[model samples]
Target: MLTVNKTDLVRHHVPVTMADRFAFRLVGGLSTVASVLFSKRYGNRAVVLETVAAVPAMVSATLLHLRCLRRMVDDHGWIRTLMVEAENQRAHLMSFVAIARPSGWQRFLIVLAQGAFYNSYFLLHLLSPRTAYRVAGYMSEQAIQGYTRYLEDLESGVQTDIEAPAFAIDYWHLSPQAKISEMLVSMRADEAIHRDIQHAFADALVAGKLLPDLPATDLDAGSSIGLDEKRLDAS
Candidate 1:
């Protein structure tokens, strides 16, 4: 099993603050929207390049988000958290490979194609790290709510400490509250995972394995597929 340094997680998060998680979701949504708009104006090529560059960021964010989620849920039982985290991780890794499966010849022709694109936007937003972090915080809150709902659905009798969000993706015809709640929760979970990916890049930077820069594209924006056991088995 692959593991990272737990020391990076400073405090024991019996229950994390909802503020940061919700903030993260907002930023993530904004970032995705911004990326899409940029792509529309610039062309899909630029978006593709940016997506490649943002891979590390995507991975870091996803990993850290999941890590925190696992810690929170797993405090009660590893079996459950492991099940969810593994599923989520597999989805993330698969998505990474799918988006990055360009031809080797094309890759060779375009050096740092992905990195250049991802970093360009990241740099623009660099001055506002706190704001960026708040985006991540929002996402975190939503994910907790969303995942709790999933658990609630699975084990109907189980009582989660947090209230399950009233909305879900499949049920998109609901009211404003339900719809917004669903989006927030789902986006929050995604942001947490995305944050872990950014952290991974940070680790690489610390190790001198990579240089600092913004990801060119928004890697997490495209895919909506969730991780499942079948996907894990195939991988």
Candidate 2:
């Protein structure tokens, strides 16, 4: 289980080095460009964008797990947050999988993208966790933008508003008859939460005052993934 002082979170986060700041900014820039190109290539970019959304969290969690193992100390709340984020994004990807019904080539593209992203993100986190986190924050911004556009399409009748997936309804506590726009709203909220967390983690890293040794129990009891099992059940 993870623990946090919500009070501090609002004001405190990792403070970053110049190099890390630059690297993170560069990634954010590239992400913006990618979002544009992806939308141009695909009708809706949510499926592919959300597929890669889980990358940073998974990468961070793996590293934090190993760090915890080697040092035999608490990883603050980073592990739980990262893992929860990964699971939440997985849900987003899952819902979109059913709705988007990606083509075979798109599916293969997912595999390739995940493989490349996972390795690249892992190395980046290893070299500089701060920058890696910033990258995730940027990626979440991209996700939000894509989902917003999808919602716009639905509202404008460019695309029909479809019934929300059962999993989305149950997991989100959305109206049983909720539609895709409602689901997208819930998802965007989740992305905003992650975006904040990523920035905070980056700030914590910069502050150099974030980590403190802890007892054996994990510090991740609270996370957005609290809804994950229910979402899975609906699936």
Candidate 3:
């Protein structure tokens, strides 16, 4: 089970380079577009966003795998780490799909968005993996904020705190009586972990390190690399 530190939920990466700035602005633009499209419909928003969120990890893993093959060198466990992240994001999508029950038009929009984002991110990764990771980092930050809003709505009775889907319960090992608010909290923590990992990858790239010595936060443990402490102290 994943244990989320409250500090991780509020951690933010301060942009330093032009690439980081561009990535931050890019995600901000997308967040605005999502807000205009979804408004207060957080469930539907999650379904669409999770579909796009699941892309970068798989793309990065594929490209890195091929790069390692070509160079006959080790990937230093990055391939598995990215693959796990991809699977985790996919699980999030499944959980939200069950809860949101998106309509046909929303489903169609999901396909279009996923297709466009996948291809664009693929090309961006080819050109600059550092910026690609930075974009993902900022995007995860947006997701955290979105989920936080959802939690607030649930708490304030603006949205009903419905029972969590069975899939989410099983995936997260939640209690049978878990509410959607609880699920949102777990998902928010997952997004925080993604945010930290992506920013760490971008930082490693900026420092000219091929692979960073991150903490061993494997799929089973559901732990993060603990970047928040250092970042918070620095801030």
Candidate 4:
């Protein structure tokens, strides 16, 4: 597995391809509704979103690693990139757990949701890696929208911007006295990068082009970052 430094950032990365389009839009619709409903209940939503955040990346990484092992090709660092993305997302979950400790019911729900998403995404990737990447890309866009609303809520006092959780400060290497909002900003950056990374891969697959080997933090084109505790890092 590969690990790398995280950063703070979001950009606009949008492309429309047939397979990627269907997958992105299908998942995007559900995420849109989730964002609308969960934008208000910050803690609960964070738990839900983060719970399933890393599933796709982890699944993809595993599959990619296996493919490389079989083919005896390093995949030009893309596997490592995927692994780093998975780890970053898991870290996001840890940060959110500190912020919003879930109840028993929520925990059960998380288990169910995670299992379902993982299996479904696994199959999707197996059948069509390109479309699977598209799903991730679009789901991320929805998450970005959700977190953008969350930031608004914090700033407007609709949701209190509590002191950032301790783990978050350490994980992101934020200032000793960083605020929750700042943590969100840092997380948002990671999500944005992942968003682009996934979409870029999908685009390459569609175009029959070589995949980029750049770090997760460095991707081409514009992509809007989603902030959490980001989630997929929330997620």
- Which predicted model would earn the best lDDT? 3
Q: For each candidate, how many residue pairs have backbone atoms clashing (under 3 Å)?
A: 49, 15, 0, 19
Model 1: residues with Cα > 4 Å off, grouped in runs: 1-124, 157-235
Q: 1-235, model 4: which lDDT tens digit per residue?
A: 1121333234445555678568867876667655675655677777787778788788887888887788777676566667777778788788888888888887888898898888989999999988888888776666666667778889999878888888888887787888888888766767776787788888787778646435443222221122213333332
> What's the lDDT for candidate 3?
0.82
Local accuracy of candidate 2 as per-residue lDDT tens digits, 1-235: 1222323223323335675567557656656755675655333356776777888888878877897889787767767767888888888877777676778877787788778878888888889887887788767766666666777788899888889888878777788899988887777667766776777667667777444233354345553433333321110
Per residue, candidate 1 scores C-alpha lDDT tens digits across 81-197 of 324443443343233233335456545534564455446435423544333333433333333343344445435644322332332322222334443224333333443443443
Runs of candidate 4 with Cα error greater than 4 angstroms are: 1-15, 32-39, 213-235
User: What's the best-to-worst order under lDDT?
Assistant: 3, 4, 2, 1
**Comparison by TM-score, 1 against 4, better one:** 4
Stretches off by above 4 angstroms in model 2 are 1-44, 210-235
Local accuracy of candidate 3 as per-residue lDDT tens digits, 1-235:
3356767788899888999899999999988888889886888888898999999989988988998899888876777777777888898899998988999999999999999999999999999999999999999999988888888888999999999999988877788999998778777877887887788888888889866665655433333243212121110
Write down the RMSD of candidate 3 (Cα, Å): 4.5
**lDDT winner, 2 or 3:** 3
Worst 10 residues of 1 by lDDT: 226-235
Judging by lDDT, tell me the better candidate of 3 and 4.
3
Model 1 per-residue lDDT at 82:
25
What lDDT, from 0 to 1, does candidate 1 have?
0.36
TM accuracy, model 1: 0.26
Write out the backbone clash pairs for model 3. none
